[model samples]
Target: MSTTINSFNGDQQQSSSSPDVGDLEKHYIDAKAFILSATTKDGINLYDHLAHCISQLLADQPREGTDLVEDISKTIKSEATPAQHDTLRDRPAPDSEHSLAAEQKPLFEKVDHSEELDDEALQSPLPHILEQAYYFEQAGIGLGKDESYRIWLALKQLADKGQIDKLRFWGKIFGTQKNYFIAEAEQNVDDETDENELHEEAHISDDNRHPNEEEMDDEEDMLPKSTYKPPPVVPKEERGTGANKYTYYVCNHPGGVWVKLPIVTPAQISQARLIKHYFTGDLNKEITSYPAYPGTERNYLRAQVARISATSSVSPAGKFKFSEVN
Candidate 1:
């Protein structure tokens, strides 16, 4: 035998599954507040039209096996219209704009003293306040009447806010913070290093060593403090026996033959090609004509190599020529 589904009437039996109308109305009010807070009105009426649909949905329950809340929510959302949905989606929450404005006010506007006002009137200006106002008004380094007014207003605000004591404290130390005339005590790096070294030395002891620490210490002691040594200067007679100790370009002029050109600056490398132009018209053509060569042999100009070593110093004390070398 086949059985057919039977429909029952719950409202007539006083046992409907639908939520109470009062509860639905309360939810509608809260939902309206949330939607209105984030969005402006569109073509659809959000509250009146939505409330009407909600009332209908609550009074008439959905068919069998349907969700009561989901059906009511769907009915309410349908009233929003497509245009209203777009507006709600595009707009930010009203509370967010208000909070951003409050945060920016402190940075752009003068400090607020409304809290301390407490319905009381502002006090008369003190003697020091008038003096400061007068000084600013009269002194002509761009402190005009506007600045004077601002100063007076700030002072009055401070007094009204019960922050006059703080203002006085800051005034006492005016222009002293990080100023050249104020000598702030500074820590010396060398002194700190010496103190740290002393502390480390004081802590060092034979008893403090681990089992492998003695071996590490012995290895450290065997090693030299530094492995570096300056390259040995080759004798002038034995120019290329090993790598050239120091390469120099000797000046070809008879008066400046003793002078050796050293690539002391970065500019000399760049100006190598421009050497001809630099010395073409000058009396020092002999010195500038020769391009740089390695290993101390004079160019085709017959200039002798001046060997650079510890015993020798550059000739023509103040006559060193500089060039831009790439």
Candidate 2:
């Protein structure tokens, strides 16, 4: 019988009223206030339009490690040169175009107490919310919003509609997770030491030897049973033995490596190719042969193979570097 295959995506049913943001409502309201008052009644103007777009993008999800309130605005960028976002920096953090002679209500202070707002709100203004989303999407960084909870809920709803059990649903969602191997056609085995130890340790008197022969004939399971062969556990310095990098992340069998090269501009690509040529000299006669590293990491290869690719200029300085400062 042909069986029907189904999938779940319950987040689509969520509206602004959804409970996921219950605790965040106050922040949401305050943010909405800033956005609404920042623009005119026609909310669809570039100001509100961008905010709505980004808010919608993030509305249904939470980033892995990002605080929505903290990172949201920085990600927005106006589609203007050097960054039309600079306009927001000039005024009280409003996008430059929106900064007119209009009376500005400071969002940072509580009107009654007359307290000074923190410098964070003052200096780090998010010019346009939509611009941040656009730039982030273009930059190819993970939209680090957290949607795991909602996604899990979506899966639950799916199982209910399909009349499926938890195990079956898990199997369907992630394919069967085999955490054993078949011992010929009749048996399967688990991997543990004592239960799997050979009969050599059966050091008793010889009286029971021949009669118990049949028991020793049975197949035994070994610990660390058949798994995908992992990379060779070599010391860090052993890496890049014959290559440029002395250390690298292993992503494949025996000796795999993963390197990330910037793919932001053509000039960067050209530079990358040149670096590759420099490292992997031409085939003795060509005078300019591209270098070929041992593994299959595109970023690593690009660094030494293709110099003139548009993958290195997008993020520079502190914005795109992949290091965490203490």
lDDT, candidate 2, 12-111, per-residue tens: 4454447666668888888777766675432334455566547855675765435564454434433221423343444356663354212122222233
How would you encode candidate 1's per-residue C-alpha lDDT over 114-168 as one tens digit per residue?
5665333443323454566566557654335553343444434334433122232
Top TM-score model = 1
RMSD, one per candidate, in order: 26.6, 35.9
Q: What is the clash count of model 1?
A: 11
For each candidate in the order shown, give its overall lDDT on alpha carbons: 0.37, 0.31
Off by over 4 Å in 2: 1-114, 125-228, 232-326
Evaluate model 2: give its lDDT.
Answer: 0.31
Name the lDDT of candidate 1. 0.37
> Could you say which candidate leads in lDDT?
1
